[model samples]
Target: MTTRFYRRTASVLLAAALAFNCAASFAYAYSAPNESDLDNHQTYRNHDGETVHSPAHSRSGEAPDGATARCRDGTWSFSRHRSGTCSRHGGVAAWR
Candidate 1:
């Protein structure tokens, strides 16, 4: 009787562990972005002179010529024909 009870308890615990691991793996996979979503998207400068693009948090593309500074967040920003330091979250400022 004792051996049977132990075996049942071990099996239950193992099943619970497997279930938890599967759930966690599924959650992680859902949270991560797939690479296929980023194809064919081109980064470009917005009307505000800041670089804006898709596929959230992607760091790609080069600034146009005469750009004095560059900034990046969800998108990239480039300053053309202007001299200053680019701010990631804000506007340009004098370089220190």
Candidate 2:
């Protein structure tokens, strides 16, 4: 009976710890920033000392507001940083 009770207690504690860990992970999980949460039209210097604008508008096709550069793949970039800005889209073609 004592052995059975200890096993049950251990199982319960393990289950409780797993549940707490899951809840804590969910609490600290990464969430994408909202447009309203961003500072729109704000200018800042990048690591290269070049003036850059924060991503303001979430648009497609044409160049949106606060676009800093254009990619070689014909995509506009609103990236705040110069490095890795248009790395995925075949690098930056022109700086706007």
Best by lDDT: 2
What's model 1's TM-score?
Answer: 0.31
Q: How much lDDT does each candidate structure score?
A: 0.40, 0.60
| Worst ten in a row by lDDT for model 1 | 26-35
lDDT of 1: 0.40
Q: What is the model-wide C-alpha lDDT for candidate 2?
A: 0.60
- Candidate 2 per-residue lDDT, tens place, 1-96, comes to 699999999999999999998765522212233444344545555565665554433444456545677778665566655567777678888987
Task: Record all residue pairs in model 2 with backbone atoms less than 3 Å apart, i.e. clashing.
Answer: none
Clashes of 1: 0
The candidate scoring highest on TM-score is: 2
Candidate 1 residue 8 C-alpha distance from true site, Å: 0.2
* lDDT digits (tens) for residues 1-96 of candidate 1: 699999999999999999998765521111222334433344446444554332232333443222333343333222332323344435443211
| TM-score for each of the candidates | 0.31, 0.37
